[model samples]
Target chain A: MNIRVADDLTHAVGCIDVTHVSISLGEEAEAFEAVSDLSFAVTPGEFVCILGPSGCGKSTLLGAVAGHLKIGGGQLTVDGKPVLGPSPDRGIVFQQHTLFPWKRVRDNVAFGPKMRGVGKQERRRAADQILQLVGLSGFEHFYPSQLSGGMQQRVEIARVLINRPRVLLMDEPFGALDAQTRNMMQEVLLDIWTEIPTTTVFVTHDIDEALFLADRIVVMSARPGRIVEDLRLPFARPRVSDLVTDVEFVRLKRHVRGLLRQPEKAPQLARLDPLGVQEA
Target chain B: MKVIRCLIRGCSVLSCVALWQLASSLHANLGVITFRNVPPPTEVVESALALLKSPKLLAHVGSSLWRVFAGYGAAAVAGVAFGFAIGRSRAAGDLLLPPLELLRPIPAVAWIPLSILIFPSSELSMIFITFIGALFPIILNTIHGVANVDRRLVASARSLGGTSTAILFEVVLPAAAPSIVTGLAIGMGTSWFCLVTAEMISGQFGIGYYTWEAYTLQNYADIIVGMLIIGVLGMGSSWLLTTFGQALMPWRRAVETR
Candidate 1:
């Protein structure tokens, strides 16, 4: 399947507009604002990373955008339509272990089209193509539990990408990996993004990660999270692993670090999952 | 190491049998328990061999097997269906769980009288008792499994464009499988236990009935043979269930080996 045609690229979709969006997590009596009036716009095909301290609702914002969590106030829209619930148009990748353990790599990747009633052979073919793109061509029959952490994440990405999602929402997708694997995955992700060119919103706390992968970084304050800065990167496309050591990259990292180090009014809240506070 | 372990286990069982044989052969009488009327191991073995040669053995074994299968099959279907409904939907839980919870604690033996009254035939009553015996473990375990399914997996499935039905079949069902299989295995054991109890009380042609008949006839060796048969059947069925479960969830093996 042609993931993205030249004609479709000219009339690009996947523009995300978050206008004064506020989200409250937990039960009504115990509810607290996770994201407070977070406003940002990601233009079609732009790679935006939400960079923040832990529990700052960076992942929560991504959750709301992906339609897994509800927006309590204001509007969160993708491609000019309200995200009422999850759809194939918006595919999300959690940090780790979200891959279906029972499914083989190919079946897991093919789940999207299978849900869409795509024929078995066609979806498998599509899955293989996407798996190859994510550098997991030979391991299609391996169960998710059989694969390494990095390989599993690659399968996770391939699973999402098989839908040819209009927007890719990643919540610290490489956070669970070791340093070496994380860097390699960053390059691999960039390669896939280059080929697909979907509107991507990645959430990460690592400054170097945000600097290297994102076209624009939306930094936020802790607790009742709101945008502190929306810094644009000057780094060129197809960024190499060596870009993290570049002087400009280091300078931007320091600036972002300073923004995150500001004293919090409230104490650090427990880390909220992308699916919001789980009901006990 | 494995061979030695197996040998030790074999010796342990053999020693137990030897002890029993000595006690029964000598008519050993402890204060609380006595082997005065018990049959020796050799006599029990002879009785088992005689039963194997008799045509009545097939009729007894076949009836018990068929009853257990029918009751356990029904329990499996209903338990899983009820479990999925209760686990996934609050409305279903609120509506269905109260009566089930009330019935869950009542032992299958306790249901013998009521089941006999409720069903039109003794055969149906025996199956109902077996169903009751197996139902709780399967349902409770299924509920636990489905409820404990990682919310992230469901959220990801939904985000990937899976409909409610697709998510249930593709994601939730498979994720809950290992626990369900565990429940099924436990259920199989319980079903056999209940079937034997029901058979003894009401059956005309079952291994349980034969055991009861032997007790009435004072044929001590045949009673021991009947008990051994019941033990073997329970063990065999549980083994079958576990094997079936492992085949269903090949991923669990991968995780364990890794």
Candidate 2:
């Protein structure tokens, strides 16, 4: 399906070939702006994390990318096309685990391709493949309510991944998980991302989580949220969790923490500025 | 525990029958409240057995079942349809629901006079009364169900490439299934109620008509039999509906398990 161009806001000319390019939220009259002059891009197969304090509209930005929210300013494009509304190409994983409770696990995973008019046999095959990838092959017929929180989130991830989206947007998908499960899920997510290598925009509050999974971490500031620090990680792919204790990892973690603590308002004039903060 | 509970239930029913029999026996001797018109348990049981043997009893049951099912089926279809329209669309709700809201407060029994005049035949009038009786609960609960479906589900469905029609059928309908089932259960009950009332008020052959006719003929035993048959039918139908509802709601079974 062709991605239709959305009417531009007249404030800025649109950018091309960028996943999640400069989507802002809120009208000028709103009590407070949710996101302001927020600009970012995700290269194909790149894993980017948007880390911020709570209520900083990181999720909102992710929502815009997923086409669940309308951008009030600038534009968001995927593959050189503006996101007029929600499309199958941009899949979203909500923190609440929005698996259709009535459907069995496999059917939930198969829903996207079914909606996209794929034949039942093909979608079923795809669903089984993805469910196996998520380690939920044995749970094909279990309802969402019968699963644990962690298992349900796994099903949620599998459901989105089955769509083979251009960019997978996740809003703190492991925030509700226990510490151990969260670590495990982080690993599983990385494994899945590596296998498919779709462009992904993961929104999270945990600095360690951002540091662990992101090839590039965009640290956002609170209220009228804008990207404050855009740092690239040099950690090798298939990096182990033990790297959190690595000397360079520790130094970069501390540095990112310091940047987040600085309370620097994202200068609008310096827009398109990447902050260029890389940890060697 | 299961055996003990069953034994207790049996004892309870036995005691109720014994008390009823005792009350009937004492009525004439004590010169107290008129249990004189009420038949003893044995006489009622005999009448029930005789009625079961008779062809006329089957006709009464058949007619009542037909009226109840026809009215209730129409109510179910129309209620869910209108309910979804009202719940999902603002314009439909604004235009359609206000008059329904106004009419809703008037009892179904109260519509008997208007229904008789509106429909050409008494059978249609009786069905109409039952329709009115069943309509409200079904429509209201369905509206509540459709209106309260998790918004995030709709958003998620859209992101997954669901069109508006697909979202309604796949997401909204299933999410609202529990509430819709509750509505159907309640609608069955109200339909039975109004069916009996309409059957009693109007002419011919039904369990309700049988009971009312027995009253006029002073056949107290047959009256009790008719009442018992109606009770059994209502209980049986509602039980079936509840079982159907449970089958439709497998997700609820998981929630109920804990």
Candidate 3:
């Protein structure tokens, strides 16, 4: 399988800059701020995880970068270009595998290229190649409904990656999987990232998931989310499952947990979807 | 267990027929109803066999089948097209829905007089009534299906670089297919109902015309035969539609069986 590699010298392509961004959910009259005056920057090919409690608006922040949700204040830019609307250059993988149920796995993966007007044979070849990268080569002919949850998310990742996105945005992509499958997926994701080396911004409530996957973890506060801590991991590349037991890893996890803990007096906020307000 | 279930089903039908045979032979009458004028299963079978051997049987069945196909085919195309338009666009819905909603409540029987005037010939009028019978169910169901398509799927398709036209065809259409098929199956039944009613009123040859002709000629057994034939045709067509729908959606079967 042939995979395209990013040029070593052109470090400017996938850079993301978020400055004093705020987002609100629901109608104008009743709307509440989900993320308030947050700022972050990601260098090209860096894997950054947005770690937050439930309803902390981390996913909402990812949505702004993906150009799916509108920002109420401040600016978001990719490679010096202001974010506008959803673009294939920034691929997103939702927590639920948003694979087209009607399409076979091969077609689902091929969809991005097909939309770009690639011919049937060529796009299908690309789909097959990418499917192999995600360890789903043999399951091409199966429909999404036929695949297990882990396999479905694998296909979802492949579908997004086939676009060769400059920035891969994942909103808890393995959050729905069983603990065993989630662990395996986290490793599989790292392997894929090793191969393609795309800039990644992953959102998750799971502390271990954030610690395992990210080069840097941006921990966020509860609703009306503000950045509480930005921690850089010292652990070396090609991370293994056993790294979680490492003393440094455990210490950082504890520190991140403490950062995530909210004040007892603060009221719990209902979860907001990346797409803005949750429908009644 | 499967064989026993089949046997029980078969016996149930046989017993119903046996009861019908006993009632008709005895000329059973109650205050509100009578089986004296009704034809027995044995007489209906004989009449059905005689009609099957007659040359006119082909003409009657063929005309009915042709009218149904022509009217139903048109309804399916128009309904789905209109459904997609209305479901996707608020402007299209506002423009198209009011007149359709107004027209929907009028039964095919009520349309017979207006259609007879609107169409140049009786054949066209009967077909129009059949078209009317099918159109509303197909259109309404299609709209319902399209409107209910998961927003996430649409959002995903757009994020994947699908244009509006591509998204509508690839994502919205397939997502709403199961609902559209249900509409089509229901529409087929109503098409038969409307066609038969229209044919009885003015048709020269059709199953409905034959049934009405039999009543006027006092051939009550032939009426029962015509009714049975109509029932069988309706059942066969609905079965074909559902089977075709299932074949088109292989993914749905995998989900359902799982």
Candidate 4:
């Protein structure tokens, strides 16, 4: 399907192709501005992490890239086309169990293509492929509530990945997991990224997670959030915990901690104006 | 294990009846309230068996069943359709629900006089009264059920490209099925209670009419038999509906999906 040209908002004057985009939701509130003109981009097949504290509009920015939120004041485009709304080209896995409870796990995975009116056999084949990829092949007939939280989220990932989007948007997909499960999920994610090498942007609060999975880590200040620093992955692909002990990884981790300690709000105009603050 | 449970249940029920019969026998000579207006256990059994042999009695039972089913079916279909329209559309619900609520509280029997004047025949009036009895419950429950389906699911469906018809059929209807069944069961039970009053007042050939006909003839035994039959039929229909719902809602029970 053709990506329709959408009505331009205030953010739409001139911009290049955007890979990783940022957004703010504080304008909805009366007092504090939740997010600011926070922006970044990743090259094709790049893995990026967005790390911030509890309420840093992390999910909001993910939504902006998913074409789910309005661009407030910054333009975000992928492949030279503006995102009017969510598409099969961009798959998202929410933190919560967004699986349709009425649908079985396999059907949930099949939903994206089924909605696109794909034939039954093709969608089923794709769904089964992703289910195996996520290690949920035997769970095709199970409902969302029947599975454990971690298993449910795996189904969520399988559902999103079935369509093979150009970008994968995950908002703390593993935060709800237990520590052991979270580590396992990271390993699984790294493996999938290695296999597909799709453009993946993951939002999280864990400093180590941001360090471990990302090809580049983008740390943001609190409210009126801005990209404070962008740290490249010093480690190699299919990352393991061994890198957590690496000297470069330890140094990058400390720098991110230092940036988060600063208050959420600073000067929004000066932060991103005239060669914006590259590091907080 | 299930068969054993059923066997235990049957024995328990029989044991209770046997105990009741023994106690009544002990008091029968004393003649206080010992199975006087209340038929003794043996008499109830005999009444059922005797009625089974009688064409006139069985016909009354069949007619009463017919009246309840026909009235309840019409009311359920009309009520559910209107309920869905009103419940799914807030403005329509607001516009229609008030008048229905206002009319709901008025006894179906009170409408008997109005129904007679309005309809061409007493059967039509009886159907109207039974419909009145069943309609509000069906509509109210269906409205609640449809309205209360998970909004997130609906939103997700829209995002995933479900047409309005698909959304309604596949999502809203299944989500609301349990509540709708509950309404139908309750409504079916209550329809009998209402049908009796209609049959007594204006019905020519129903169990309720026969009960009154026996009362006028001073055949109190037949009156009691008719009452007992009415009670049994109502219970039987309701149990049938309950079983049907349980069958349809098996997955719901397992996963708590609704």
Interface RMSD of each: 2.5, 4.3, 3.1, 5.8
Q: What's the best-to-worst order under lDDT? A: 3, 1, 2, 4
Candidate 3 chain A least-lDDT 10 residues: A1-10
Off by over 4 Å in 2: A2-31, A262-280, B28-33
Instruction: Give the deviation of candidate 3 from the true structure as CA RMSD.
Output: 2.4
Interface RMSD of 2: 4.3
Model 3 residue pairs with clashes: none
Summarize candidate 2's per-residue lDDT along B194-247 as a digit string, tens digits: 888888898499888999999999988998898888899999999999898888
Q: List the candidate 1 regions with Cα displacement exceeding 4 Å.
A: A1-9, A264-266, A278-280
The candidates, ranked best first by DockQ, are: 1, 3, 2, 4
Best by DockQ: 1
lDDT of each: 0.89, 0.83, 0.91, 0.76
Candidate 3's DockQ is 0.60
Q: Write the per-residue lDDT of candidate 4 for residues A18-80, one digit (tens) a residue.
A: 433444443345333446666666676778898876556666777666766666565678767
Off by over 4 Å in 3: A1-12
Structural similarity to truth (TM-score) of each candidate: 0.95, 0.91, 0.95, 0.81
Model 4 Cα shift for residue B230 (angstroms): 3.3
lDDT of 2 by residue, A1-280 (tens): 4222363534232222333334443345643446667667777677889887766677777777777766667767877778788877788888779999889898999998898777999999999999999888799989898898999999998888777777788888898899999999999998888887778888887889999999999988765577788899999989788989999899988988886774467433211101111112
**lDDT digits (tens) for residues A1-280 of candidate 3:** 1123555664546899999999887786998888889999999989999998888998888888888899889999988888898888888999888899999999999999999888999999999999999999799999898899999999999999998888999999998899999999999999999988899999999999999999999988887788888899898988999999999999999999899878888886776666875634
- For B22-80, candidate 3 gives per-residue lDDT tens digits of 99999999769999998899999999999999999999999999999999999999999
